[model samples]
Target: MSQKITWKDKLDFILFGWIINWAFPQYYRPKYHYTRYRKILLINVIPQKILGINRFVKWPVHFTSVIHSPEKITKGILCDPGDNPGIYIQANNGIIFGNNVGIGTGTKIISANHNKEEHSKHDTTSPIIIGNDVFIYANSVVLPGVKIGDNVVIGAGSIVTKDIPANSVAVGNPCKVIKHNPPHREKFTREEFNKNIPKQYHHYFDISSHE
Candidate 1:
């Protein structure tokens, strides 16, 4: 930790942390959410993203988890970075991933999709968004200008290029919805199923429950 600290350098640790918290999440989150709505995920990250490194008491701890620069993630937000390791957003606009998003191994998001014509692409880029509970399989590429709705499952080795509906299962290049998840619950009736439960003998089939 001492090697990372010096008097000559700006060592306003607490102040820098507050700045990171107040500014970075706010800046990136908005654009990230918007890009999702627009179905243009995979865009280069916006700018000035803060992961609260300034809030850390130990320099070594903070440095280990830090991602890339602000310019790369101009205005994007990725909650639960602990689970989504090696995840990076590179977009010109916004890229947002909702909570509980299970992105499988070796997934790469390339958000910056510009016009093939170099002249027209100079100032144009798209975005990408993955909703909550969305499961992206391994080795998947989610391109720019794409949106994956909630409860969606992306097949492994698929390339997503379009907008997916909520509760849908999509697979293949330029992914398409193969199935939609329906609301489901499990239940057992007394006639054929309740007998399996020991009733008053044990409420949960456990001797302790009778007590």
Candidate 2:
């Protein structure tokens, strides 16, 4: 069971980022591009300032978060990370997002999870739960009570209407996990991926004299 975040939670998240974005930009390096600075201004810093919640972020105007709407939402969350501008969330008692969620351009997440027994669910609303390290590509829409598991990748233009397990890759209109990225495997870290090897090591990696 995830928690429903409040307006204060939004402010707290944005305000706390200043030490990283403003004072110390190195620790919390922007994973995307520099344009994120302006996005932070528009979505996180600006909205709170206008609404008179709290304005702690200033300078460089960086954003690692997007719109977090709590109005009429009963449970869960609406997390739109990455460079996307906004998220329009509607739910009665459900919605959640894991850390480092990359929602592509123009994505919509429905809060309401459906109940099959309710034949009258023409306009029903439920909750949506997303796991950690989930990447949702562009124009993806997630319906209610859909539990997107950790380390999952939702392909672009997908319409997710069911529960997705962890370490999986899902795609299509009714998204399904086609690829499963098993956990606990020894994988390359960013540092490992970018490791600069000595010329002697060329034979070890695919420097391909083989090619």
Quick one: best TM-score, which candidate? 2
User: Residue by residue across 61-97, what tens digits does model 1's lDDT show?
Assistant: 1222233322433221223331233444344555666
Identify the candidate with maximal lDDT.
2
Model 1 TM-score, all chains together: 0.48
How does each model score on lDDT? 0.47, 0.52
- How well does each candidate superpose onto the true structure, as a TM-score? 0.48, 0.53
Candidate 1, residue 74: the lDDT equals 25
Residue 19 of candidate 2: its Cα lDDT? Answer: 32
- Candidate 1, residue 211: lDDT: 23
- Model 2: residue 96 alpha-carbon error in angstroms: 1.9
List all candidate RMSDs to the true structure.
17.2, 13.4
Candidate 2 Cα outliers beyond 4 Å, as residue runs: 1-39, 42-44, 51-83, 113-126, 182-211
